[model samples]
Each structure stands twice: as structure tokens, then as C-alpha cells.
Target: MNLQRTQTAQAPPAPRPGPVLAALAAAQFTVMLATSIVNVAIPQIRAGVGLSEGGTTWVVNAYGLAFGALLLAGGRAGDLLGRRRVLIAGLGLFAAASLGAGLAVSPETLIAARAAQGLGAATIAPAALALTMDLFPSGPRRGRALGVWGAVSAGGGAGGVLLGGALTQAWGWPWIFHSVAFGSVLVLVAVAALVPPSAGRAAGKFDLLGTATVTVALTCLVWGLTTARGTGWTDARVLGALLGAAVLLGAFVVIELRRPNALLPPQLFTTGRVAAGNLLMALLGSVWIGLFFFLPLYQQQVLGMGPLTTGVGQLPLAAANIIGASLAPRVSRRIGATATVSAALLTTAAGLLWLSRISADGSYLGQVLGPTALIGLGLSFAFFQLTALAVDGVPPQDTGLAGGLVNTTRQVGGAIGLAALATLAGSVTAHASTHRTHLEALTAGYRTAFMVCAATMAVAALLAVPLTRRKGRADGSRTPTAADPTTLPRQGRATRRTPAA
Candidate 1:
């Protein structure tokens, strides 16, 4: 009895809920805010910079390409340099870049600045998430923190369009960047004042070679895919870029296998949970990203909705996202993360199927609102749960890398999925246009895309079934608690014990 009491007393305390969680969520919000914030301001940016329609696209792609490609390096940097230090450095870079973008006088200057902003975002995002995990001891505390994180992340994406529209119409396009810069400043201050310091740097040299290989490979792949959206996939440049990416990626694999200190440690892939979680994230990203990208096109081109109205129309999705995120922890506690995710994917797929039935003349009230809400809610359920699962049993030292992998899968998946789905939709539309009216062709294309999205979600659901069986059957078959020894800081085997989730 005395031994038992002593052991219980020595156990680490549960992480108390606090303001640090809010600051971390704010950091995530600011990082994601930049992603879609510039979308609605495109017309104004083009007019100001005297950009051609094609050139304006670079404004968005520049940031995405840089951000998506550099994420692994950034996460590893945080692990080596100290997450807090790297986070501060990242925020500084983001602020400077946003300021430059706001004050830019030419398209070249703006695009360059956007790319710099992406670099900063890549640096900040993984650090923020890793820090959140460190601060919130796992279990309900971690779940709640993740709930807020998911809400803000999704909210930022949804709100960007609305905020951009309002700022562009009322203030100016530059104000969009200006506003984000201001918010970032506030978040930085909160982080510095509120969040605790990260652990000292891990014992490893910076993997510069690995970083270069992976970053260049990802950039090439993304560039090829994005370029193919406009140019044919068979274009010589696109083909060359894709081939180069494949070769570089192969080199990166070889380098990681051989290197003593690699950017992404081989141990990360050893866990089936991490691997499967990332795969599921990719599929979820593909469906949702495709939906978000094309829905606006359908609205503006097919239904003739204005930018402001379209932004407003997305309000349901935003609200439902918050609702679902808030509830995911409770649901996962009862049913397990794997089951929650599987159910949510099926729900989202059902919603996507419902949406596929929309006509060219579909009204927001009749066709768009219900399905959007459903998708948003379903996505929210899976988003945070998958995030937790990806790093569930990882060593504390690998947290940033785990975060980076999760986000990387989602971003890359979204980019590739959107490009492929859009290409398919375009082909169908063009072929159908030959025999059908313009509206009918457009509707058919959108419907086909929606159906494809539904199928993708179903596949994700099927994959999630194995997640429930991975481990933790004795811990009530629920999500693993945050304080599980296997997930704690790296220590001797004697210090670690396998705990059921």
C-alpha cells in the first residue's frame, strides 16, 4: 500500500487547462490564415500590380509551394534549435514578409514576398503544434486543446474569404496582409508572454543535405502538378519537372536510409499508427480541399453568386466546424479515435454524395448549406483525432517532425487531389459541352467531382478500421491518454512502460 501510494504520488500531474492553449491555437490560426487570406483579394492585387490573369495565380501558388515544400526542414530545425526560438524566428520572418507584400509595388515583389511568407509559415506551423502537445499533457486536456486548434485552423480558412472580401471592398487589398500582420503581432506577444519554453535542443546535427533533397523534390512535384492544371499534363516542362521530382525523392529516400542523422528519422515510419494516420489525413485532405476549391467556382460561375454572398454562404461550414471540433474529444473518449474518425469519414462521404446531386440552378438554401455543414462537421471530427493519432506514441523529441509529417501529407494531398480532380472535371466539362448546354456541362463536371470526393472519403473510412486494432485494447480501447509512458520524453527502456490507450 505504501509503495502504491508513493508511485501514484510520483506520477506526473495532468496538464491544467490554461491560456497557453489559446496562444497555441492562435499561432495555428495565424499560420492557416495566410493560406486563403489572399484569395478574395486577387482581383485587387492584380489591378494594383498590373498583373495578367495567369500571373495572378502565382500570388497564391508561390506561398503554397514554398510552405508545403519546406515543412519537414522547418520542423527539424525547431527540434534542433529549440521550438520556442524557432517559433519566434518564424513569426519575425512572417511579419516582415507580410509587410513587404503589403507595401509591394510590382507583381514580382509581391510574389517573392508571398514565398517568403510561406517559408515563415512552414517554420511556425509545426513548432506551434509540437508545442501544444508538449504543454497539454495528453488525454482530455490534450483533446480540448486540439479541439480549439482544429476550430481555429478551420475557422481561419473559412474566415479568410469573408475577411478578404470585407477588407478588399472597404479598405484595400493590402489591408488583408496588413490585418494578418497585425494579428500575428498580437499572437507573438501572447506566445512570448504566456507559453512556456520548449525543451533544450535535441542531440543531432541539422540535416542540411536531407533537407535540400526533400525540399527540392516536393517543390518540383508541386510545381509540376500546379503547372499541369493550366498546361497539359503531357507538356514537356511538366513531364520533366515530375521526373526530376521522382528522381530527387528517390535520392532523398536513399540518403535517409544511409544518413546517421536524417531530417525525418526512419523510426517515424516504424509505427503503423503514424503511417496509417498520415495516409488517412491525405485522403481526407484530398476530398475536402477539392470541395473547397471547386465550390466557389461552382457558385460564382454557375449560380452567379457575388464574392460577399459566397463568403456568407460558407458561414454554415465554419460554424459546424467549430461545433464538431468541440465535440470530437467527448465522442472519441466514448468510441475511440479510430471509430470517431471512421464514422466522421462516412458522414462526410454521405454529405458529399448529397452535394453531388446539385444542379446548375441549385440554390444555397436548397442544395449547398446542408451538405457543407455536414462536410465541415465530419471533417472537424477527424481532423484533431487524426492529428493526435499521428503523434500518439511518438517520443517527445519527435513531436515537431510528427506535426510536420501530418501537415505535409494534408497539404501535398490537397494540392495533388485538387489538381487531378480539377483536370478530370475540366475534361468532362469540355466533352459534355460538345453535346450539352453550358450549364448542363458545368453541372455534370461538378457532380462528377463531388462523387469522386465521396469515394475518396469512403476509402479513408475503410483504412481507419485498422487504426482501432493497432493497440490499447486494455486501456478501454479508447484514445491513448497523454501521460502514457511510451509517448513521453526519450528515456531508458526501464523508464518507459507500454500503456493502453
Candidate 2:
């Protein structure tokens, strides 16, 4: 077996990829596009569906709740079944859900349909990432692939804002969903034709108990945080939901400890890089998602910009993000992923600090653009570096799980952090209103939120200190082993190496 494996590794590599990457990137982009595409259209959606403001919030939360909670299960399913199979299934589900959301007549129906879309996203994201990892062997080639993926992933939310505004203004709020639905169908077809079949399934039983517990816990937690923005943290329903989350999460931990085929194996967490990378990703998500959520509101309400103008204003960010992502791979090769991530975090913090000075009468060009560009650049760098580092030492069989875990942190952290920040912003606004005009009060709230974002980024940078150093090969560069099961071989049977960088 050892001799066979050595011979296989020395064999010729797979053919150069062509359309495969484009399809995978499109799949990822569409899933993330749903996250913020509706933000600018919230008012239009509310008016169209006759939704109360609270119901409107659910339109967003329902999707987040489902997406954040089910990511792990979806990832594991891809590993147990087949990555390609899961990706196709997920895309199909998303397309159908988007159709329902686009056509729904009532808020409840739309929210449910949005939840279905989230479920589809949950399934698609992990599988798509795992497939990308599978297709691209780590080295300069994988780095380039990840650079593209990272740029697309980071830019997707900003792109969504742009696309959502245009679609909503030109057509209607429903077109936002319709557009994604149509795109999903195209990408699904492309994926079916371009992506090769999965090598085989992993040997394992689905950890049903573990899956249920973690999913329920995350759902409860995200739902509670989202609900608290409207209902207040002290509200009984919010409190109960949070309590239920704690209980469920506790149960999940116990289940994982005992289960043989756990959804989130405990050993993964014991690794310093995995643990640190995930925690940092969560912090970054908090700030990133918070910025995406609030910046548009600040621009529109405070700066008196229209939806189209607001979307247009964000174009610099999208452009800057792509530039930064494109550069991160090469930068990491020089400075190491850890240092690159840490510097990017600090850069983001600096940018947030600068932006925190936002006033009631701030100029978009003067105050907003500079910091927005800086943060965008920093985010792209941090996002790609963190993603690579997070899965650095994991075995091929567990690659899907690693992808799911990191993505889960991103989604869940954004949900929880946004809630906490929103609460803080609300309190600040209310207090400032006693002494200032409404606009001034609102500016104070936004500024305070930005300061908190800066603080969170600073903290993440501090945590990254230990991660800056890693043990690599004798040349001080990490190389991918041929036994990596994530890689698709053009010649021989799939086999896996023991986990290493």
C-alpha cells in the first residue's frame, strides 16, 4: 500500500482547470449574495408585503437563522455523501426557495421562503468550499484559486448592495430574489457540467444527535440575538431563547465528546491554529457584517443618500476588497499567514477608528470613502489568510468539516455581534437624544458602534500573536502531500495522508 501510494503521488497531475473554478466561485457568490441583497430593499419589501417593521426584521433573521445553524450538518453531508452531489442538491433547493421568496404575497410566506433559501445556502457553501479545496492542490496554484475565491466571497456582500439597489429601484424588491434564483439555476447547470464527480464517500455514521443539538443551539442563539434588536435583551422571549441556546449548546458539547462520528470533532478544537483561526474569523465577521448592516443606514438616514446612491458609494469598497484579496496570497508567502492576518486586523481596526468620528453632517467623499476603502482592503487580506490558516493542518477527510466550521463562525458571529452592536447603538442613540437632535443622536450611535468594531479588531489582532509562528517543512514552506484525499487524481484511486501542513 505504501509503495502504491508513493508511485501514485509521483504520477502526472490532473489537467489544467478551465470552467470548473468559475462555476464554483459563482455558486459561492450567489449564496453570499443573498445575505445583503435585501438590505437596501428592506423598505420596499416592507411596503410591498404590508409587513410591520418587526416582521421585516424576520425576513432577514429567518434566512440567517437557518443558514447559520445548518452549515455543519451540510458540510458533514457533503463528506459522507459526495461534494458534487451536495452542491447540486443545495443549488436546486436555493433556486426553488428564491422563486418562492420572489413571488410571496405575505410577510410570513416570504420569511419562510427566505428561511428555505438560507437552508439552501447552508448546504451549498460548505460543499462549494470543500470542492474548491478538492480541485486545487495547495501551492501557488491553490493560493491563486483561493485568492479569487476570497475576493469573490468578500466582495459578494458589497456587490449585493450594488445589485440589490439597482434591481429594487429598476424593477421591484422581488427582482432581488428573482435575479438570484435565475443566477442559481445557471450556476447549478454549470456546476453539473463542469465539476467532476466526488471521489467517494467517507466511512462514518451521521451523528444525528450531535447535528440536532448544534443546529438547534445555533438557531436559538441567532434567533434570540436577531429578536433582541427589536424586542430588547430583557424581553422574555429573547431571554428564553438565549437560555435554550445555552442548554442546547451544552448538550451538543456532551454529545460530541461521546460520539464516534461527531459533527464537530473535539480534536479539531484542540489544535491551536484551528482554534485561533476560527475565533479570529468570528471577530472579523462581527465587524464586517456590522459594517455592512449599519453603513448603508448611516449613509441614507444621516447623509441623505438614496438607495442607488448608497449602493454606488459602496463600489470603492468592493473594488478595494478585490485588490486586497488579489494581493494577500503573495503577501502571505513573504510574511506568513499569521503576520499577514494580524497586520490586516490592525489595519481594519485603524480604519474603523478613523470612521468612528462620523458626525451628523459628514461628507461621503471626505469621511466615508477613505475608511471604507481601508477596511475593505484589510478585510480582503484577513479573510483569505484566515481561511487558508484555518484549514492548514487538517486531513482531507476533515476538510469539509473545517470549511463548515470556519464558515459557521463567520455567519453565527456576524449574527450575534450585529445584535450586540445594534443594542449598543440603540442605547447610545436613546441617551444622546436627551441632549441632542435626532440626527446628532443617530450619528453618535453609529460612531459608537464603529469604535466598538475597532476594539473588537484590536482584540483579534492580539489573539493572533501566538499564531504568527508555525512549524513547517525544512525549506520553511508548506507543501501539499499527494495523499491528500481532497485532491482529485487524474490516474489512481483516492487516498489520504495523515494531517500536516
Candidate 2 lDDT for residue 197: 82
TM-score for each of the candidates: 0.87, 0.90
Cα lDDT for residue 73, model 1?
A: 82
Model 2 alpha-carbon miss at residue 294, Å: 0.6
> Which regions of candidate 1 deviate over 4 angstroms?
1-17, 42-57, 433-443, 472-501
Separate clash counts for every candidate: 2, 0
Using lDDT as the measure, the top candidate is: 2
lDDT assessment of candidate 1:
0.80
Model 2 lDDT tens row, 169-199: 7888999999999999999999998888887
Q: Give per-residue CA lDDT, model 1, range 1-501, as digits (tens).
A: 999999999986654447778877888888877877776666578889888654665676677667777888888888888898888888888988998999999999999999999899888989999998888765567777887777877677777777776777777889889988888888889888777678666788878999899888877887787677678889999999999999999999999999989988887976547887888888887776677666766776688776677767778988999999889877777666667889999999999999999898788889998998998898888787788777767888888888888887777777667667877787788889999989889989999999999999998898789754456456444333442222323322324555431
Q: Least lDDT summed over 10 consecutive residues: which range in candidate 2?
A: 482-491
Candidate 1: 10-residue stretch with minimal lDDT: 483-492
Cα deviation at 177, candidate 2, in Å, is 0.8
TM-score leader: 2
Clash tally for model 1? 2
